[model samples]
Target: TPTQAGHATIFPTGTSPGTSSVVNFAPGQTVANSAILRPGAGGQVTVHLETPMAAGTAHFLIDVSGWISTSGYEPRGARVETIEPVRIYDSDLSGGNLTGARKVSLQIRGAVSTDGGAAVVPPLDDVVGVIVNLTGVNAYGGSRPTHISLVPDDFDPNVPAQQPTTSNLNLVPGQTRANLAIVPVGDDGRIHLFTLQGETRAVVDVTGYLVRREDDTRGGRVIPLITPFRAFDTRLSDFHAQPLGPARAEPWSFEAFVNDVKVDGEPVGKQAGLLGNFTAVDLERPITWYSPVRTHMTIYPHPGGGGEDENCGAPPNISNVNLGEAEAVPNMALLRYGSSGMGPNRLCVFNLAGYVDYLLDVYAVVLTD
Candidate 1:
């Protein structure tokens, strides 16, 4: 079923009710949301949908992209390490379009500069997977919709890798959109991008990487929750039902134990990082606004809690989501905690411009062993 406007939350079965990972959809539109979920003992997860329209007016679908396991004969488990967002590839710099049915390969390991010759944060070796923000620049402007597929870089360009059924980012004509993706890398430390239809430029920004636990002792092992938890929402009555005003930053805190799941024996407040989905909603624009406002939301580790301070200083260059007026968009983020005085399990959200409400649904925690 389709609805005028609706949202759905997914979490582990039998967990007490709370906002988890949320997918918000507009009228007459089919939007897909993704989140990492830990199944119950019976390998089950639950989805809760909320809509203003009648119950029968809404419908939902679920798909499994991949899974993590250690019980199999070949036991494969990996940990994640966050890095400063780095631009690795941009088709525009090469003066070409990522034409349909074509594959472009980009290096992932030990990279120093972008394809445009800009310096970037280099990733470590032995990376099994990478989390990136894939942007599809609408070079060929029109009203048509298209998609980009990310694949393992093990095929030759002449042969052309088979495009997967799933797409990493969906693009609308004349609109540049980005989506976060966790893609596996080839044995040679590279990944491939393929366009499904239409000619468009592509951009790949690396945010984090995954490696086997034994291979690297620097990162944090991922602890998937039996159920995703709603860490914070500025729209809820109890959680302060007010939109974050322009140029404001707010810090929200979380406990180590969520739904009776503990990091270790003691309450370990400090964590290496958190894995979750961040959604920006109800963006407010000026009355005279005509053009699409380019806005962004940044989530970073904050030192303290409560109240806004003009002296809070400028936010880092990293952003979680690019926002537009009256659009609700969600992106997956892997955020690292501050090493020094920053409080434990605390993160701050900063809005670049305009008032906006945001939601955070955490699916996993990163623990340094």
Candidate 2:
């Protein structure tokens, strides 16, 4: 037999380059040998056997022994809340060691590709599942979380997340799942990023990825993409309207008046930009905090600025007050209020319910600070 097919071998570490050989195949039939794989310093060796595979009928094994860091799993679907892997700060809650009285924000960026690529938009009415991890710390310096409070950006203050009413968690250290799950209703192709913070334990950030719908579609390899949009904190002067009393003890409310409210020295001014349902997060993502042109509805305690006096009510004295230039930040905002009312008076606030919008409310009252 002259040789059904020629074969060659190389011994770089031993003797010759192409002297010794192994004849390992027959003619008219394709063949492949498992490769001899070894670990290298950030390196690899691939041996390509001259073989032709059938229509999806080929298998080979390559043994590899190497060291690599463990990667955190990525989550997906309009992520209302997500954690980033950046260690922003660390504090020792022991010995009452306060770490500079800081406020943290949390947010979930929309989905992104694994390779930091472009955004992918799925079909409408397609629902994606979401997950949240509540990272904490333990007494033994282990990884865990104490408590987590998740509030969606579009939530009504009357209906917020359930907090630990008694003020703490009742669990042994190191035994808790740091996560929450929510399936929101929308087709904005966004990730539900949740902003979070902690009082006692250490915290970890979250990353997100997505999975395809469960419908019977063609199964193929698709890459996930992240379009991160963050939510920052904003200081709302009169954020809360009256707490919708009878339902709430001290009814917290918000309101605005026509001649009663003036902005930039103009009656019925448009200077008061509404901070409609502002949201904050301990995470670092960009959020377009909505600023209202005019509040939902306009209400007043007493018209003519003295109508409340007949009811034994003192007129609201809002003077010397000037709202500084309106500027928006990641998680914070500023609105200046000074005194410009009739006399040194008392101001009562109300939520904007009967006056304008369904979700608007007047929340605060300051004399002249």
Candidate 3:
């Protein structure tokens, strides 16, 4: 059940949605959040709604500082968080709304730092990517659309891309909206913020970073599956895949070891994680309707080649990625593999609530295993 009502943005493109929610309403205090883009048709996507709104409507905002894509990425790079969220820019304090195609630039390098004595600039300069939150406040919203684009000054916003939050934000005067995204940064070491129409004051904050590791032997690489496979169908034939029905919860386990391939072709099997689409379909696969309730899925590393590990010890905390009962939910998580790394060999997913069944279609796997 929802403690509050807000929406979530999984992936995004330009423009907003007709009727959608990107965040599950948040209280007045600061809350930690994050998301990865899931491309849609024409490469454009609508912000995903974690909780449906009820009688009264509330407001929200979206911030996207970085993104993930296999086409080109930072190798061995990992995402890091700031000790304290650092504000990089503030239009209200700085004064002025960005009109038309005008852009705002922020030098993010030395502005923030991690507890390790590494500043956002120096230790991150060579890093393939950095993570931050982009925020807009008291934004302008008229009869026309109000669209903002925040990308690396060097790269153009990918059009056929999905949006950061739900599309077409209808900000009423000083109303605010914020969401999250992981975009590539530019060579000049700064990000460019712009709006397609209207004017709005925006803010940027530092979170963590994705940097390349010097040692490939202990690093990770993504392995993609050409087509999705129904790895575990609760309604399948066999002892393994069992059905998790509406308003019920159960732990489903499966195997992920298929011979390994290193992008560098070295040996694999230290620890591994999965990248896949999580779905809830009836036995036949058709569109399904939903009711308001908190339905979540959690994926974790289990002993390879078996049932759930009773003494798994903390499931390699990658941070919890909250999911709703949508037809399909996509997730990417790092499984803290046990030191025996030869094969985490096993993985498990537990459905929290709601009757919908699940299907996992793996696109890639990042392994040290």
Estimated TM-score for each candidate: 0.79, 0.20, 0.42
Model 1 alpha-carbon drift over 4 Å, by segment: 1-4, 15-17, 55-65, 70-75, 113-125, 137-143, 155-161, 199-201, 215-219, 236-242, 247-270, 287-294, 301-313, 316-318, 339-346
Q: How does residue 74 of candidate 1 score in lDDT?
A: 31
lDDT of 3 by residue, 1-369 (tens): 234444454444454442222233443322323433445568665544444444333343545443445554445355332222345566765666765445566665565432235454454566545444455544355312455555665433344343233322223244444433354666777766665556676655554444555554434444443333345555556534555543233333333443543445664454344544444433221234544444444445443433433443333212123334332333333332221233334555554455445555444455552
Q: Of the candidates shown, which would achieve the greatest lDDT relative to the real structure?
A: 1
Q: How accurate is candidate 3 locally (lDDT)?
A: 0.44
Model 1: how far is 16 from its true place, Å? 6.1
Clashes of 1: 1
Candidate 3 global TM-score: 0.42
lDDT (Cα atoms) of all candidates against the true structure:
0.68, 0.24, 0.44
Question: Mind giving the per-residue lDDT tens digits that candidate 1 earns over 304-343?
Answer: 4335332334565556677688888887787765422443
